[model samples]
Target: MEDHANSRHKKTVQPVAKARQEVYVLRDLKEYLGESLLIIFSVLLALVLTEFINKQHEKSQTKELLNNIKEELKKNKQAEQEQYVYQQGILKRIDSVLRDPGLQKKVLTDGTFHLDYLAPEGVSLHDLSRVAWQVAQSHDITPKLEFKLVEMLTDIYDQQARIDKIEDKEAAVFLNYESRKPENIRETLILMRDNYHGWAFDRAPALIKKYDAAIKEIDRDL
Candidate 1:
């Protein structure tokens, strides 16, 4: 009778132990699922923050480049305005020199021939001067003279070549020059400048001297 009772009690205890094991396994599964979800959320949040930072940095770089371009454009416009002003001053001075009766007579009859192309037409010197100042901040009479000098130099250089056959000794000296390009004829000009008094016996060199002065002024200002 006692053995039978003992067996019955063991059977009841075995089912209870099995139920406890099932409850513990379910609790552990729930904890593992919660931990996995938390890890995934953290990874996604970090990716979003990194993306936001990258986009902000790109936007800043783009803005900086645009600002730089604007500054460059502004500087270029200002420089152009200044150049226009200087050219206007030069035009005014040229018109004045072109109009003076005495100067015109000297230009034509004296055979110095500086204003051969500048005709007596268009606006007066005063008006042009005003216009020039309105356009540019500075007056520069040098460019007008520089343009004329370039033409005169070209003519003078041509004359030298023509005289080569007539004066072989002088031509030989010219040929031996380091560079005889028309542009390099400033060397010959300096020689003439040094011996101006002796050379003036033949032709009035006022135009040439004025041309030289204009070039010097331009160089100094520019």
Candidate 2:
């Protein structure tokens, strides 16, 4: 009887010990799962915070670029206006020569000419304030700018390039005219007069109008 009682007690104690072991395993599993979830949450939060910061930085950079570009446009517009006025004066001078046949005769007899009447002093053959544009292009920021602004900027720059080329050609022609002999003076004066008239009346005024439009747009946007 005593041996049977001992066997029953051992069986009961073994089952109790096994149940406690299973409970401990479940508690450890729960803690591990909690830790894993916390780690995932922390990583996700960091990623989101980093993205937000990057976006803010980009916004600030883009705004600064726009402001710089706007300032440059204003300067270019002013330059265009001044250039237009100067070219108009040149055109008037050319017209005076064209109307007076005696002026051509005088040039031929004198064997001398004033090249200043063709191209003035302040007019440049290139866009001087293109640094802002160069920076924007190098930074690849066109896509960030307003569409209309980009279009106007592109058009204005292209017109400037065309004007520069024309100015260079006109300069070369004038230089050649100056080097010519007395017999060729009249023909050279006529060519120079016609070139100046065409550029001053047509090309220069058109470019000035474009500059005005661009300036207005930039002012409105800014």
Candidate 3:
């Protein structure tokens, strides 16, 4: 009977030990899962923080670049306005000679008559500086700017470049004239007339509009 009692006690003790081992295994599993979750949360938080910092940095850079661009534009506008005034005055003088019958008679009848009133292309040269813009483009900061602002900048600069090329061509053609002969004079005057027609009607208005539009857009951002 004592031996049977001893066997029964051993059975109960074995089950209790097994139960304790199971409890320890479950506790270890819970600790491991909690630690893994904590690691994942930390990594996600770090990634999110890094992204936010990058965005704010880009925003500051965009604002600084825009300010530089605005100042450049303002200077260009002033220079362009001055050129416009001088060229308009020159155009008036040229028209006075071309339109008046008396001046036409003087040009046709006089064999040695000199015309000093021809408008020089130098007076119409516009100020174009793209250093700030070039920097923004080269460094890839332009993409960080608002889409509308980027579009406006592209249009303005592209038009300015086109106008510069066209004006250079016009100047080259007019400046190649080496003779003061009446026929050469008349031909050059006609060329000037055509060039100025485009300038006064289209190019000048477009430049003023572009500058004003860009300034307005920048002001909204600032």
In terms of TM-score, which candidate is strongest?
2
lDDT of 2 by residue, 1-222 (tens): 999988878844443455434344446788999999999999999999999999898777876776787788778767767766776776666667666776645544554556654455733423537777778788888887679988888877776666665566566665674535765655665666566556443666676677678777766755
Give lDDT per model, in order. 0.39, 0.67, 0.69
Candidate 3 clashing pairs?
Answer: none
What is the TM-score of each predicted model, taking all chains together? Answer: 0.29, 0.70, 0.70
Worst 10 contiguous positions by lDDT, candidate 2? 15-24
TM-score computed on alpha carbons, candidate 3: 0.70
lDDT of 2: 0.67
lDDT (tens digit, per residue) of candidate 1 on 106-218: 43342233322231321111110122222221323224334553454344333323322222332333344442444334453233223222222112233234334434443
| Superior candidate under lDDT, 2 versus 3 | 3
Instruction: Please give the TM-score that candidate 1 achieves against the real structure.
Output: 0.29
2 versus 3: better TM-score goes to:
2
Model 3 per-residue lDDT at 93? 65
Candidate 3 RMSD computed on C-alpha atoms after optimal superposition onto the true structure? 10.5
- Which residue ranges in model 1 land beyond 4 Å of their true spot? 1-28, 84-222
The superposed Cα distance between candidate 1 and the true structure at residue 48, in angstroms, equals 0.5
lDDT of 3 by residue, 30-135 (tens): 8999999999999999999999999898888878888889988888777667767766776676677676756654544434433344444553556578898998
Best by lDDT: 3
